[model samples]
Target chain A: MTVSIKITSPLTNADVEKLRAGDKVLITGVLYTARDAAHKRLIELLDKEGIALSAGKLPFDIKGQIIYYVGPTPAKPGQVIGSAGPTTSGRMDAYSPRLLDLGLKGMIGKGARSKDVLEAMKRNKAVYFAAVGGAAALIARAIKKAEVIAYEDLGPEAIRRLEVENFPAIVVNDAVGGDLFVQGVEKYRGTGND
Target chain B: MRKVSVKDITAKVKELCIAAACHLEPDAAAAIRVASEKEASPLGREVLAQIIKNFEIADAENVPMCQDTGISVFFVEAGRGVELDGSLEDAINEGVRQGYKDGYLRKSVCDPLKRTNTGDNTPAIIHTRMVEGDKVKIKFAPKGAGSENMSRLKMLKPSEGVPGIKGFVVEAVREAGGNPCPPIIVGVGIGGDFEQSAILAKKALLRPVGGKNLDGDVAGLEEELLKTINGLGIGPMGFGGTVTALAVHIETYPCHIASLPVAVNIQCHADRHKEAVI
Candidate 1:
């Protein structure tokens, strides 16, 4: 039962700095959902739009906002949304640097990060958080509302805007080059199973 | 001769798709529980706890446990004594269409090159074998790609032998790390041709979690690999702990004397699969 640091979205540089790898946080605010497919589309959208950050071509403002790497199941009758969970982040590595350049503050996903993505995060002062991989049913409880905002033609991979409440996540990689995945492994390695 | 209606097959498969999607089987659930108590990392323990609760929540709510319900895969044992009145494959695909739509499971199948979604999660990947029985046995495994994409198959030289198989399987899991979602179940297939070996690896996953191969040597390899994989400290969701893989299952077949084929199919903790005799 870890006491999580409660925070809201549109996190500032101070908010990102106060966090360290492995610290649990509960986020209550708006989050945008995107996966590899949506990410590719976004980068293409940006490249097409040129140097203007908010060239009016973008779907939503990327500045200081977090993009959760997820493609969730469909909602049933009387349900806000279906099983929503974090996907592997490595899949989004190729396009992340471009997003980071635009002041994207945080990312939520599972698995390890690529070196390029890490370097970009460091340069842009962003953070990476991880939600439990298979914990979709439980994770969905924290999401109060979800609506597709872009790429609806992508089906489940469509980008969506979500209003979340007390969403649980663990900071995996911080702007200071601290990574929970690396640190956790080093601590337990060669300790052997008991 | 027994007449097996495709309708019954369709009905059964429909039910199986929903069951496999929403529920976590007993073995998987129990393995996570065992890991939770022994998990060396507090964060790993916490993750394991969430997995346990996630399954329970899905079961109670009758919703899918994970967003990616997976590509519907089936292993069918069609009895020699039974005669099918219609196309078995068509029935299976129809079931998938209904199951995915009605179950609210995500339609994840897509064209490989064009990258266009099929909209309905069909046509299923079916492996049918003729067996000596009056009833048909269907086993359903909706494979999530996070783990499926990480699965690998290799053609080894005959001289590489058991050591080669062991090394490849362990290396695959290491490379996959948390991508497939640990603590994972590692399924190893050996001795068959390239495609057959891949199927053997996947079929191995349909076995009861922690179940050993009947071959004594194969079973030994499974135990050894299980221990080595757990030692990697990938832990639950790769946050690092002692329990990386819950089990390692191996299935083998006789292959060419000149070549040794091995496949490793990694399965996440969700491990949604079930079987029925109709």
Candidate 2:
């Protein structure tokens, strides 16, 4: 079995440089939750703020942070949160580049990314990780705490701040443009019916 | 003749909805464990392991296996002799409403254009068929959008034949790549009108995890497609590995000479489904 590397979020370039696609990692620190609706709103906020000729400020700082593309269920009583898992990331491709350019260091989600978003990640030294899709209840356990930071009216689609511990994920895209999905598939492809 | 109560149907659907969320159907669960053992890529194996572990945790804690508890979908086998005291449709919708509420499952249904939350997760997509038996069968499958969004439909010319069907199915999985979540179940519907094709594709998903089409030729195709998909190496969660799809299920119906309609419905590793007969 390949061993997992332990890493903290708010990752620096040096940390990102050492990572590669297919490397298992356990993340510990703060992760911001946002899915389709939240991503759209964040981009609109950026645009409006930019138009005002003010510091293109956001509800939270985008620098050195990771945005998790997830819209979790409402928590049960006496629970921190409900089954919280990553939604497909491809849906957010349209809005992701803008955030990545603003110094966002990483993202956690499932599925492949669009070309533009991926190029943006490589250009900006950001990384993409894949959490097991539909593995929400298990993933939620790593989230020690969660609270809505913005866009509360969107409910599950709202943006929230999560404090996590030993959050498991695998690096799918790295800063240097290594893609596990591509390489892995090519490796086994046409090694026919094996 | 069996007299199935409308309230009973509502009650059963309610529990099935909740159980479907919290539990990963046993066959799918077992398939993942089997896949984990044979996944060629270490990363792929890791993903399968996590999927299995997630279901176990969800089962024990009675929490949803995934947050996107899915858009509630049902297939009902209404017996010809059974008399319903009330509206069967209303009972099913009410059951979804109460289940999503009481179970704390996500209310994902929304108005397409208006994008408004239905609030109660109502108006389930139900397909009912009357059968000869006196017993009513309710099969519930909560479909997560992650996989459903990848589904596709096509009307092939009669010339496309079996090769055409196989080619289309393989290409659909290829294009779908890791998005539908690898280690997926490919449900292919052939030989029906456009809408019926789509429905058959979905109904194909309700088959037991490792089950095959009874027709010998169709069953042969299922095996071949499984090998080819696994060869794609989309692996588990599309991180690349040897096991891209757990199974490919094909359901076919007779169609017009000039037209062949095909639809592909992809189910992610979660594969949440349940059924009960009354």
Candidate 3:
């Protein structure tokens, strides 16, 4: 049985907390973007001794938000961005727990999560979603706007904010501690459900 | 006595780079189609077919096949008799700059310490060798990050032999699991020291999928390794299916009698690469 989910625009913390594993999401919302370098910088700033992103003082509030881990190629003339698709999320594992704690609701990327990340999602009531890793052109259709938010020095890997509608993804992990990769593998392995 | 201009080199490299990024090499595309047909698992077959469709759409729309357009790596064979009007290094860098720019490919390189993007995608990793001909040959492999992250090299005692080499390669890919993207192409570099082995392994990716290893004994090992890898059931994206690996390519060189060095360079299904001889 397949479960489906609808993610509305201008999402709030409440909307994100409701996602479950195996749910197919038709996400219509605004999102933020950050790849490896941006995530590193964001975390470093938070780690600084005297610096802080207190609830109201941070650059942006992440509660009920979705983050896409992507570093798209530069777009051609008349295009907004090029090859805008999800990158491997595992590389962001170190910084994710902190973001989750700070009210991150959902993550969109390809591949599996680290053990610590999975644990953080369970504790924080966030969800993990997967976009087709290489389907950049297809995914780009969902984006209505994309602009850099911070860390411009990182080029394509820099952090940005995106507005999207009907972005497609499948929930790979949920707040209840279910894991799609693990379950998906086990289901077909013995039964030869090929 | 043959003269080559930096502009010519740059233009050629730039053109090849974009071509490779936008289009799947014919052989690789063919291999994916064949794999899709032969895959036993319905899920695996579907995954394989989607990958093929991805290549088609990417080519049709002139977009990259995957978001991680990868670091710019080049293997060049230059002729001793040829002269470049400007620094060959400059020409190569200029080409990468233009390629990434004009191709709309990702500029992935960064300052290792600062972790800041170079913006122009300059200072590409280049390996050059002088060959007998007057024409220069170039191979471009825009390798993605996921596959590069899973690459590994191990130095073993010569006594460890074939079985040892096989075990290490399989272990590295298994540990990588879904991370590298499945139906991987495993390039095994045996012999040579650490760096040399890695270079050889990367070079092995230039071979067409299903191409036989030159060494008879190593070729046998290649077949055996391919079989063992498929048995892991990691499948496409490690989602669990019948075919985990599409092919394993092995290259070897004579090493010190006491040393056996092995390096594995894993390539995901995207496998975007190209070659040119001029």
Candidate 4:
């Protein structure tokens, strides 16, 4: 059975703990957008900051925040944002573990994550959600506002903060190591009886 | 001989860019609708429903169906007797630049290593073939990287044959899982040289969804592959259902006796493409 729930971001450990693979969610509140390019920059900034406290710092506070993997098309006049859908998540696997360790709680993107990412999520009590791939126009409707916060020169790959309402996604991975992709495929395998 | 203006070609290409971005081709839309009806999983059904609604919103609002407006790839059939005043390639690039800018489409092209945006999605991948008529026909397929990245090609030993080809195709989809965004359209190219095989695979996707191949034997193979793929339960977005692929299109050419080349070009459900003739 599938259950639908509403989640407001800057998510809590408790909030993510309740999510499980197969649950449908409507994520509201503020979500940050970044794709492969932005993620690489973020990781680099963090590394440069080093263990020793320096004047250098991350551009934005990532703790408890949810990052959406996306690089939307430019908006037309009178539109808040253009078609904004999730990109594939696997490409960010190399940088995800570090972000999760920084207290990032959730990720919204399509596709499976690497083993390292799943392990990191398990350790950090993070969750992974999948917005519909290629359903950008419908997904953009949920975003009420958009503003670039960093890496403005990256064009579409720039990091933007979005205020979203009722943004639909399904929980593909949960803190406890649940993965919907594996479960779903196993359940439906050979059901076609070919 | 018919005279075709480069400006006219540019205009047509511009119109096609926007059209392909905003509209989900009718055949693909129909396949999704049918898949939704046949989907057994409640979650899979819901995903398909959302896809249908997404296209509806895209059409009504004049927004791109997906953010990745994609790499502009054009297949041009040039009439041998037709005369053009300007370079065909430059006109195509100009068309892409104007279309992407005017249409507010994402400019995804970059210098791979440097990762600098081209800003105007220019220099489209154009494949030209000389045909027997005086009409120039163009087909534009805006291919998103998500599916394109998952596509595969292999040099198979002739002894591997049909069974080998079948296994390779299925494994590619299985490995792709949800990344390519199933219910996909699989285009198979068999028996060409390395580069030719890859191009053949992509070209096969130009065929209308749900249409059968003209060759009966090849058509039969398409059906068999389709059934086997759906059986893997990749489903819509890999959430699991009975409709992993809407169609399997195969294009074959004669090859050297010792070598067999195969390529699989997977296209997501969006399948954005359009065509025009001048």
Best-fitting candidate, scored by lDDT: 4
Q: Which scores higher on lDDT, 1 or 2?
A: 1
Candidate 2 lDDT (Cα, whole model)?
A: 0.89
**In candidate 3, what are the lDDT values of residues A1-194, reduced to their tens digit?**
24357777455657656776666688886888987777877777787733455534345677767889988878778877777778888999998998888878889887889989989888877888887666677677788888987777677867788888888777788888887777766654433211
Q: How much of the true A–B contact set does each candidate keep?
A: 0.70, 0.72, 0.38, 0.70
Please list the residue runs of candidate 4 whose C-alpha ends up more than 4 Å from where it truly belongs after superposition. A1-3, A52-56
Q: Which candidate should be chosen as best, given DockQ against the real structure?
A: 1
Candidate 2, which segments miss by more than 4 Å at Cα?
Answer: A51-56, A192-194
Interface RMSD of 1: 1.3
TM-score of chain B of each: 0.98, 0.98, 0.97, 0.99
Per-prediction TM-score to the true structure, in the order listed:
0.98, 0.97, 0.92, 0.98
The model with the greater TM-score, 2 or 4, is 4
Report the C-alpha lDDT of model 1 over A1-194, residue by residue, as the tens digit: 77999989988999999999989999999999999889989988887777774724678888889999888898998898899988888999999998898889999998999999999999999999999998999999999999999999998899899999999999999999998888887877766462
TM-score of the first chain of model 1: 0.96
Each model's DockQ? Answer: 0.74, 0.70, 0.40, 0.70
lDDT per residue as tens, model 3, B29-121: 887787777666665665576577778888898888777788888999999889888888888889989988888888787788977678877
User: Where does model 1 exceed 4 Å of error?
Assistant: A52-56
Ordered list by lDDT, greatest first: 4, 1, 2, 3
Candidate 2 local lDDT, B1-278, one digit each (tens): 67778899889999999999998888999888888888887777877888888899999999999999989999999989998888999999999999999999998988998787888888899999999989889999999898999888999988988888888888989888888877899999998798999999999999998798999999999999898888877788887788888889999998888899999999998898999897
By lDDT, is 3 or 4 better?
A: 4
For the predicted complex of model 3, DockQ is 0.40
